[model samples]
Target: MGESFPMKSGDDSHSYSKNSLYQKLASDTVKEMIQESVIKYLDTDKVTSSMGSTTIALADFGCSIGPNTFLAVQNLIQPLQTKNLEFQVFFNDHFSNDFNTLLTSLPPERPYHAAAVGGSFYGRLFPRNSLTIAYSSQSLHWLSKPPQGVNNEAGIHGSGAPEPVARAYSAQFEADLGCFLDARAEEIVSGGLMFLVMPATPDGLTQTELSALFDFYGYSLMDLADKGVVEKSRIEEFNLPIHIPRLGEMREVIEKNGCFRIERMELTNPKSKVAGPLDAANVVTHMRSAMEGVFAAHFGASVADQMFDNVVPMTPRIADCFKALHHISNQLFVVLTRK
Candidate 1:
């Protein structure tokens, strides 16, 4: 397993808490599915009876600093609340994550007792069969670490990466996702429900629009390299620690793990009317919030800041690349039952 890399922290303009509307939109697209799945598949009676406890434990794995996590937790607990059960909600992520921001920004009238668990979700974070529900949104795509010894000189993601690099990413995701499933299997009670939402494709292939975005990002970084602002070797050495899994790949992993039975799964567009278009500015902000940590780690923070700052003025030139992405269905939503 690799180490944990968290999203950008704090409440600043570029912070994940402020710029994670993209993830929030993805979460919203599956809100109804989560609620309905809980109602139909979650055996609350069985969990309470088996544990002999009314306090239902729920966990949000990879929950970054957020208002989004708060919304997701509420949705998952809403159905259980009708049963008059007490709730313990665990907000989990990397130890470096901004738990202070998450804890302080929590809804004042929230119904459950909340605690922060610091660590990677690719491993167990709770005692065996202690959770009644497990949820992760826009998070699982991130690998425990970038694939070792893969030279992805083309782009940061698998979109335009070389064959070896792409395979490495896919293989790492398969293993990391396996670890995640195995851990969640031990954590969730029998008949418990797990909901996941993340950026994924039909065949684990990179979408054309996403490829274009990656290319644009590559262009921006190479331009910096040309200006001697950052090393070309560093650019080539850097690959984003994320993998968008194919539906078939996900199915294979779930079945192979033999711990959770797939209840429902679907691919959908995360586009939203309220969220507006996938314009250049929106893309830049979302990428910065999500990737700044990775970038800052590879390059210095000052260099990362300079690179993103330079991209802002060039948005007019790159606006075309980010357009038309709204028509693509790139979000994967899944519901699982702990067997």
Candidate 2:
């Protein structure tokens, strides 16, 4: 599980400065898929009668400032014009998240009222069984804790070796998986929908793979830290707690809750034909807000910029990263319906 970082509410200057580059590169496809998945679970009869009066509260878990969120709302509302369900959308992240920018980006005329909810999803954020739908993309891999018995110096444990570290991560994964489901069970209403998209290995994530990715990210960040571009102390304070749950692992979590039923499970390898590596990096940057702490802790403050710079000038390298990702089937898309 990934550790939580303190988020900034409203328009904090530091928040904007830190996340600007990332927000620029949000992915339209990710937004579209989320919208589509949620729509699939709408109670049509209930929605039609509401006429924008019935409260249909939707949440974008770990939502950040970017076009992808707007696109998600666009896709959600377009299908609801006829239904006219009163929309109350909440953009949720840690307190350190930039809520102001997200609000500013939204149109004032939108029927929905948007608010930012701070804190980790491993805890409750809503009234029991109150939310109508919840959506999270590329975010679930972030766990709330490092594997047990491993200190922060180990760089998120299990990212270094295959023996005890892997076991530690797996144990932590099982515990966090339970926490996530329990929290969601309390929050999502009966018949509600939840959509999650994240990076995962075929047999679930192994410590070795996690270690490699963490090493890459940590090395990149340490490089910037060496340049005094970002504070090394801050890096130490932050924790990159991601646990890439396999399909079975996720199923185990959901089933244990016995509140949500799997509606769809897909493994997507989205390929884009952009000009070159820079364009590819742009896609990554857009996705960065969701990954801020994970990369930042390792690469320091300049990590995001460095990643963009590295990918921009090197097409082959960018292609290679993409290819490597695909080679391992690194992404997963899942949709669940409330029982």
Candidate 3:
């Protein structure tokens, strides 16, 4: 199974809390869309009636240590609050996530009962039919584990992998997402809402800027192996736990799961507040914040540090690779309702 790797913890320069601007931009981009979806598809009256209560129970899956998670929760809650209903908000992530940072950083005077639930969302975390809403942003692309039968010669990321390797990644994603929907189907009450947002490709699109970023990293590792700084066998054994699904793949998984009805699905282009493409330093920092733990776990911390430090100065094309990062419509946003 693909192990759960938590985002880099703490509030320092390399922390996920500080480096997750792209995710924040995504949440901001979808804020209005989420509100509109809530008003349009969230059956608050039905939720209350089905659950025999006024306190609506909601959970944010894969909620890493963040201000982004808080923003997303508030956006979802605001639409429901207009109806004057009570809420019990659950913040969930892998067991190793920094709950201390996540919980303490919550807005003071926030109106709602709050608690943290730690576990993989691929399995059941709550009692059956107990939740009124489920939300996950920038989370679902992570498979429960790296796929079996993939090796270094196939490349590191699904976007740049060979055909057979890409198929392996897709198969793993389908299975993982199936488990996720099954768990949610059991936990969520009828008429509850589920909203998902993550990076994904549209049908027939072969490459994305995100893919190029990973391919760049793969090349860096290869260069390191050539210099005898890292073993070639190590690269062969490693695969990133991320899979960017195409639109059709997502629809297929939801359909196969037979749990929820898809209400809205589309691709969105998030506009960054910053003026230009991220410089090599910021780009590397952002990638490290989310992925350093994974790399450290695969390679030792010292080796991982050397690899990243070497990547910037050795590769001048990194900046050009990410130039159109924000301009592309790579994000998948979908709203579903429990049947």
TM-score of each: 0.94, 0.72, 0.96
- True lDDT of residue 194, candidate 3: 97
State which candidate has the highest lDDT.
Answer: 3
Candidate 1 per-residue C-alpha lDDT over 1-339 given as tens digits, one digit per residue, 9 for 90 to 100: 565668888898878888887788778888888898999998788889998899999999999999899999988988777787999999999999999999999899988999999988999999998999999998998888888888667646736567787788889998999999989988898998899888777774566445566666677788899999888988988877778778888888888889988999888887754455577777788878888777788888988888888778777655664455556677788999999
> By the TM-score metric, which is better: model 2 or model 3?
3
lDDT (CA) per prediction: 0.83, 0.60, 0.86
**Model 3, CA-based lDDT:** 0.86
Model 2 off-target regions past 4 Å? 1-3, 6-27, 30-40, 46-53, 151-160, 204-213, 218-239, 272-321, 326-329
Off by over 4 Å in 3: 272-274, 278-280, 314-316, 324-326
lDDT of 2 by residue, 140-257 (tens): 6666766545544545342444455555666677777677767887787677777776656666445322334455555555666688766677556544465666667777767777
Residue range 14-63, candidate 3, lDDT tens digits: 89999998899889988999999999988788888878899999899999
RMSD of 1: 1.8
Candidate 1: list runs displaced more than 4 Å: 208-211, 272-276, 314-318
Model 1 scores a TM of 0.94
RMSD from true fold, candidate 2: 5.4
Cα RMSD for candidates in order:
1.8, 5.4, 1.5
